[model samples]
Target: MNSFFDGYVNSKTTLRLFVNQYENALRDKVEKENIAADFHSFKSIVPCINHYDIEKQFQSVYTNSKFQEFQKELTRKIYYYPTFIKKEGAIEVYQVTEDMRIGDKRKDVVYDILLNEEEFEVKCSCHHYEFRGILCRHVLCLLREKRIKEVPLKYILERWKKNVKRKHNFIRCTYSGMEDTSVAKRFDMLCNTFYEVAEVGSISDESCNALVEAIDKLKILFSTNLDNSAKDLHVQEGPSCDGKSKTILSLVAVRSRGRPPTLRKENKVDRKSREKMAREKKAKKKEKENNVKGHSMEIIKHNMNDASSAAGNLASQDEIAQTVLVNSSAHYNTFQTA
Candidate 1:
């Protein structure tokens, strides 16, 4: 049993080490990929083919991949022409037709676009922004007709932004032994906030000293609160009723919910020990048998000596009787002669 437990513990340790190594390797791989992506996006520049101010804005803000997608829609805007339909309150509706050509077939697809000029918001029936998070050619065409210089800030998704720092990127990988807990997320958010503060604070010596002092005060305050809370938790006891403490006194050892384990297979050490015990037991039994036999022989010899002594006493008694009889007969014959 001890050996089995030892083996189980060793295997668990080995498995944990393997998992740690694998997680480290996976984290390194992801870091390399992210670095490579950043390098590629930074080094390579995609020229603005449409020469539109909006295309240039997208090229500067969006990553290379997302910029290419926007460029495709920008280039395809020539095929779409928007016609003003009607105005309803704040929204002006327009019908945009696309002159799409596939191989040898030509198809015209009409899409309805609602434009809010006041808010600079555009919604298209193609639902490109809704699905793929990119403005459709129809909406771009309508925006072009309206002479809008750039896309709205709301339409530009943070996920595809080149400069935006993603929160998930700060989160440790799933296999990196750090769970994606709310605390971790909050920590990342706080780190970003503090980083911005640090950047601003470092602009001047007074601001930097003030920031450091404030951070030290906050750290002390938080530490004190944590210690107090921990102390309170430690002093708190289990609930009691009617002045009686509800404390667990003892626990019974319950059998596990399974069939009892069979005898373990004997290893070389166990086998040798068992054989040694068996040999010692057999020798003890033989010694006990010899002692019993020796005791029996002594008892027989004692009984034989007592029987020989009784026989010798009986012979002496017979000789004394014969001598008394001979004397009696001699006395009778002398009396007769007188």
Candidate 2:
């Protein structure tokens, strides 16, 4: 103790003791009186924090349960007295210890916190900020010990903020029509829109069934229309490569007045083939219905015949029973007379 006091006197360390003691006394008084500091609204207390950062902190603290738990932990006396080591540059280091004891266990967790005092940046060895995008209790405790009244803006990550997705370019449609637009582009748009509707409709079975029925109706309508309009289309030769004529002809529509060149006609043979296919389908469906009805009628007739046979057998059994009773009565009377 004498050597420590002598070293303190020699190094003139006690010169700043009055200021440190005064801050400690004020903190103790605040704690004793239950006076709380409003970190959100205390703009002048902590450095490098503005109104925008305050709003972001509020949003993150309220919405994130983990952050709320961290706040609760910050209120507890978990961290030990932080020790600072000043370096030659703007970066300084703080050592913090936590009493992680359970029922007399002496386990202590220590962390090295790095702070750029000039830039108001803080980081801990736990990597809580790196992994979870939030300041750890070690850094928060050091900040409190240093008399910082508000958290710095650099500690508040953008991802946790409520206004993260407010920008217009975050999710924009990429399906603008262009000269290079192909079937794939239309297909991509189709899938995007279809999935949006499907996701909503998939919430309930009724909605899903409604969507399915609507799609079925659309399919029928499109198929019938395509079959009816097939004859108006024609096939023509397209540009070939390497002086080779391509066997596959491109289907082009017969031009009409006031019609765009992009319009293409369906092949006449395709229309006839589609009509034939539809007729075959109808014929098969009718045959299937007739077969089902015939099978049902045969089942009914067989059941009726079986029921009549059963009724006749029951009647014969009753008649036989009556005859046996009469014979038994006659035998009894004869025996009595004898």
Candidate 3:
């Protein structure tokens, strides 16, 4: 760290260098990712092991990595078997049992599956789709049993689609030397949209002609609107020669030439102080809790003592009344005898 700082005149320069290097690394990583995606786009897809239409559909739609995950589920579906349990209206209940082997010990794991016939929707107790966004072997086995040729469109998430355009890809990187303006971002978005449209339109002559006609109409409308906007701006300005020049004041304050105030680099002393404060706060909290608990216990003990004393006093009063009654009865007997 000292050697790196020695190369720079000030900490600010060092920080700027560090930030530039980090951005460059990020940009390189993004480029690599793009290259990989392009490679995947050109590469031939892996042949389906099961040769199922659903497998081929997934292979075409999903990225290579995600498709491999689906393929694994497809291969593993053999271990799962779905048995019809009962039917209730449009929904059918099936008990799917997976024969899984772990370290030579085999166990049967049961999962409940609900199939909606009308909607062609299926849900499994395994919750694999809910958690991983991928269908589980149990669901696949059930689908196979039901003879569903293709996976539902709802199940194929856009996040895993191979040809899906991501907004972040068009955003300018910090080290790219390009201004990250809204106009540039909008242009990139429009280009991506047009590229996708062109790809689709090229599929047939009718679509190509329709797309060209629509673009021509849009161009005419945009040109008319621009001409009207320019005329209105010209009218609003009145005359360029008659406009007065106004002076703009400079900023009152300039930013300091050092590390930014928002960025605080914690050293050993600061970290230790923070840790010490945290420990003290925790100790104080624990002490307060203990005091509260002790106070509660004291109150409970005092209440028990008060209750015991009151019971003892009642018992003494009863004994005194009994003694008085005995004495009064003896005296009455003596008088009667006299």
Colliding residue pairs in candidate 1? none
Residue-by-residue lDDT tens digits, candidate 3, 192-253:
99999999999999999999999999999897766555322110111121122222222335
TM-score for every candidate vs. truth? 0.46, 0.31, 0.49
Candidate order by TM-score, decreasing, is 3, 1, 2
lDDT of each: 0.74, 0.58, 0.75
Off by over 4 Å in 3: 1-13, 101-106, 176-338
**Once superposed on the true structure, which residue ranges of model 2 sit more than 4 Å away at CA?**
1-67, 101-105, 166-338
Report how far off residue 78 is in candidate 2 (Å). Answer: 5.5
lDDT of 1 by residue, 18-137 (tens): 454444445545554554566666668889896679888888778798899888888888877899889999999999887779899999888899988888888999899999888988
Query: Number of the top candidate by TM-score?
Result: 3
Candidate closer to the true structure by lDDT (higher is better), 1 or 3 = 3
lDDT of 1: 0.74
